[model samples]
Target: MIFTGSLNAQGFEGWFNKYLLPSLTRASVLIMDNAPIHRKSAISQLVEHTEHQIVFLPKYSPDLNDIEHDFSALKRKRMYASSDTSLDDIIRDYCIT
Candidate 1:
């Protein structure tokens, strides 16, 4: 289940307690994207004790996160063909490139 709000530690805490735990009866390993917040002490503690398995994908691999592709594509679409001369200009270029 995709947790739509902020992907921060607190958000994950709620997600874990609300959505993830209730489905524990199923039989399958949990495959998760490599996100620092997901590896927090609170979450790790809970996951470690549960029978539900978890796998963190390789670090620095954007291929593992589809959201990365979507965001990158959004950036590409927001940029312009003209070269940027300033940092803000570059940022704006990404807004409409």
Candidate 2:
């Protein structure tokens, strides 16, 4: 979640190194957006250590990321076009996903 400021680089690194890496015996390729944090050296190291490759999606092209559509669908179907007035509301919306 990038809501704090920037994306969670170290957290992403941990997820990759500790969990996503060991998730599969073979190398896996990760497709991602071209966020500055995603291109940082630490994340690069994590990708290398995990034997997974990050294939960044083109800038300004959320259509290329499959999750974008899913998120839109979730917002449309569950949120009922309501503004996320609180953390609870946001969490409840995501639960419907």
Candidate 3:
């Protein structure tokens, strides 16, 4: 689930608990960027008690992440779209294929 509120550590913790934890089926590695929220003490403790592992990307190396390319492609597709376009419509159009 996409969280639409604060992007702080607390928000991340809630999202991790409500969404991520329940989706896992077995021990796995989760790769994430070096964001402060991802490295919070609460998140560390949570992960330590779970059957999952969290690995952070090297700092200053966003180019190694593929999500950036996905977002860039999405932005490029909507470059000429009207500013009034609804987000739902945009998501449907971009993701429906």
Candidate 4:
């Protein structure tokens, strides 16, 4: 899921169709932040056409986004982690079962 450059609407469209859509095991909610690319009319149309639902988080509401807490913890861990520690290890440590 890492891209070399900033994501534009077209790139997101391709990724959504090629990757995200195919990975769904069942109908689910795809919650996203209020990024411009995520707000595209085409993106909404694509999701609406599927059984899955898409929801955008309220603007400036990091407390409502669970990932924000994980990211904050990750940053704290990264700050103290040894140089030899791998990112995968850090993420695995913080991963919820």
Candidate 5:
């Protein structure tokens, strides 16, 4: 996994080169939401040079995104783990680790 202090275009580009590109076994279709960072021109150029193709999801369709479901399950588990803890506290605990 790639870790970074931010989630902007630069951070994503770094992750793509350092982690995603090297992990690929074959040309793949990458499905992504239409976030501005994913739409960056430099990111498109980078993808064009790689063996992967990106396909953006339709707008406002979280139900169609598998990662969204994973996050929802994780949120539920975290909430259950510390029902009495404040959200900020739980988030801080996670971020610090």
Candidate 6:
């Protein structure tokens, strides 16, 4: 989902319930960075109620999180995009491939 503003706990919770939770076909370990939204009790409660688990990465360890690399690459690729290029197209071409 492309969100225009910062993601708050409520937004994350909604996305978790609507998308992430349903996508888990089996019990899985979800590794997350130490973002404040990820620490919300409601999100934790939801995850705990399911077979999936959430593991927070150690503080200040971006290298340990794979998505950071993807974000970096996305930013780099976005720099080269023409003014008319859409974010969805950039992501599809540079990230999703």
Q: Which candidate wins on TM-score?
A: 4
lDDT of 1 by residue, 25-76 (tens): 8655777776767764676666786777767666777798888886786566
Clashing pairs in 4: none
For residues 7-85, what per-residue lDDT tens digits would candidate 3 score against the true structure?
Answer: 9877788888888888999998988787888864677677888889878767875588888877786787677679898
Ranking of all candidate structures by their lDDT, best first: 4, 6, 3, 5, 1, 2
Judge candidate 6 against the unseen true structure and give its global Cα lDDT, from 0 to 1: 0.84
Q: Each model's TM-score?
A: 0.47, 0.43, 0.52, 0.55, 0.50, 0.54
Q: Which stretches of candidate 5 lie over 4 Å from their true place?
A: 2-5, 61-97
The digit string of per-residue lDDT tens for model 2 on 1-97 reads 2335444766667666777667778877877777665765666666775566877666887888888887786666555644546646665867775
What TM-score quantifies how close candidate 1 is to the native fold? 0.47
Work out candidate 1's RMSD over C-alphas: 9.0
Better TM-score candidate (2, 4): 4
Off by over 4 Å in 6: 61-97
- The sequence of per-residue lDDT tens digits that candidate 6 reaches over residues 43-78 is 678898899988877788679889999999999888
lDDT of 4 by residue, 1-97 (tens): 7779788878888899889988999999988887888755777788877899988777887898899998999999988999999999999987852
Give the root-mean-square deviation of each candidate in angstroms. 9.0, 10.4, 9.2, 8.8, 10.5, 10.0
Every candidate's lDDT: 0.68, 0.67, 0.78, 0.85, 0.75, 0.84
Please state the error at residue 45 of candidate 1 in Å: 1.3
Instruction: Give the higher-TM-score candidate: 2 or 5.
Output: 5
| Alpha carbon deviation, residue 28, candidate 1 (Å) | 2.8
- Higher-scoring candidate on lDDT, 2 or 6: 6
Q: Candidate 3: global Cα-lDDT?
A: 0.78
Alpha-carbon deviation at 25 in model 3, angstroms: 1.2
**Candidate closer to the true structure by TM-score (higher is better), 1 or 6:** 6
